[model samples]
Target: MSEQDNATLIEVKGLYKLFGSEANKHMHLVHEGLSKDEILAKTGHTLGLKDINLKINRGEISVIMGLSGSGKSTLIRHFNRLIDPTEGNILVDGTDVMTLDQNQLEQFRRHKMSMVFQRFGLLPHRTVLDNAAYGLTVQGLSKKEANERAVEWLETVGLGGYEKQYPSQLSGGQQQRVGLARALATNAEILLMDEAFSALDPLIRSEMQDQLIELQEKLHKTIIFITHDLDEALHLGNRIAILKDGELVQDDKPEEILLNPATDYVEAFVRDVNRARALTVETVMQPQICRITADSISDALKQMRKTDDDYGYHVTDDGYQGIVSQETLEEAVRDDNGDDALCEKVYEDIPIVAPDAVLEDILPETINADYPVPVVDEEGEIQGELSREAIADVLSPDQVPEEAAKASQPTAT
Candidate 1:
């Protein structure tokens, strides 16, 4: 998981939920080490959740994922107190949700949290703009102000021209855009999305995932998304919480889960995942140990020779410039007499990968590039370098087929 500061946005502690007419009566059975099936068979009470302890940080997407009866949805409902916990507490920014009165809970849900449901929960009679502005309107904003804010968010979610159309008129994806626009229009700090994109077709689902990622980069809303799809969890989550039989089995970042699964259940979820797409350049990059300025041609060549490498990165006060090949430096030393000769020899057209760029994206560049690809940040600052060997190391399987491993090697050009 990402190293979050002590500042926690939502803290769920010892949370348990039982579904039955006399649920509270079965609390002792739960305390006595009764299994979910045993408790259900004896008391006719379903254990919706058991001792769910999680700390949701601010401005991060925390995904809850599991199979059909895994209680993933049940865990999220407690965030906004949609379902009351049979025992334990849910503290939102230090306020116990279980203690909130009806009025206070209503106010909290209106201003602090917004929900996007799987069924596109848009009212068929209300126009797109009205549905988007529903939260603002409920909060007593004037129609003019509410519509203005809704229009801006609708445009933000790519639904600008559909403001006057009804939900029945728009396609499934467009309707979900309206749903997102509705959630965004509220300006709620916490967003609870329950399989919000699951209803869409595969292509539209991918697009919505991309859109959510793009929006999160700009908005940074504290989102708690629920999904059974492991790919969706891996793609959208900054942290993922996996539930199994009403209990949390693991909670961790995507790469951590991929590299070190907590259990066989998690391993099964990740076993078929394309690791290259899940791992980023930051995960495998080496420190940029060999670097030289444009003025240091001889020094750069010496460093390259000592390291047994053919190239070194050209850097400046601003950040990274590009790669400098030993051949370029040797030619410059032999032909150019000027002090700035080394500067002219620096290859400024070298390939670059961003720190956040996935390994799958970097593979093509690494395979084709003559020199090691420099991993740069948004400001063009060189963070590290990635080699073809490093790529192969990360992609190597634990139990590789003999011929497959041999065939996977990149041929020299």
Candidate 2:
């Protein structure tokens, strides 16, 4: 798919799974929806997952998070058909994974998706080189090509020199690197990571997260990572889905979940987050924009100076428009014609941006760009000013207090 196609990559509809036999006392409870007591009374088996629905997008990272036995792992396992949904539709890239026959399901699992698990599943008997190449080898490539690809992935995963070593010779982190190499070698568009770093030490886990970020940047692959750690979810997920008892309680961008969790359970998960770092331009950009034509530079500048904002300004054929800035005003003033000295100046090109850009995030762009960047609508119309000072103010710890104190005191002429 092209980069612009933000279509759903994976979709799940009302997925459900239950475990029990006819003699299981919980059989009646299963009809009512199994509770702990009902399951214990009816049969020993527990309900692993309940109805769950989710969608994953193309080329984005979505994290699934929950405590142990919350059905997180069980839900992810259903993605590649490792566990089939008892009654639901799982559409992977538009194909119904649940509807796939055994042969088709096997082919889909082998080729369409790749997985990384908490335990590094490298072959004990095989050399690291062979273990890394196992996926390609199974795909019917020649030994030479598979090894070549394996070596390439080894280098990709930063383990270039350990190709011939056995699994026993590697550290836990190193073995996981081998597992990562094996997963990437498949070149699957969708990657499923099931607590891939949960087994590593804290420091090692952090390092692995860095590596994962780097890999995602380079490959732009769509990923679904499962973890119980809220901090890890915040650090790595573009969006997160919180599951409890096989149900998705919350699925949203990290900031949304942090700022407004759906439940106390989810709120507890995000209570300690550093919210400022997680926010983006998409959240803080001003909604109001003033349109400016080339001839109305002075007016635009005056508006900008009056508002003390630098966002949502534009230069259209009618006149200069957007978030006003002194710089924009000055540029517009420079375009003034002799006949309308106050209105004539016109700036041909104006920088434009979305309203959601946070202060610090947008300041450097405006400071370095040719003009005050115009906060624009999705269609590129001037919406507001993206001011450097606004960003600086937001980044400055004492800005609010200083501004308040100054405002409260009389100003010197």
For all candidates in order, the CA lDDT equals 0.87, 0.73
Q: After superposition, how far is residue 266 of candidate 1 from its true place, in Å?
A: 0.6
The C-alpha stretches of model 1 lying farther than 4 A from their native spots are: 1-6, 304-310, 325-341, 344-350, 396-413
Q: For each of the candidates, give the backbone clash count.
A: 0, 45
Residue 336 Cα positional deviation in candidate 2, in Å, after optimal superposition: 15
Instruction: State every prediction's TM-score relative to the real structure.
Output: 0.89, 0.73
lDDT of 1 by residue, 17-112 (tens): 999999988899998889999998999999899998999989999999999999999888988988999999998888999899999999999999
Clashes of 1: 0
- The local distance difference test score of model 2 is 0.73
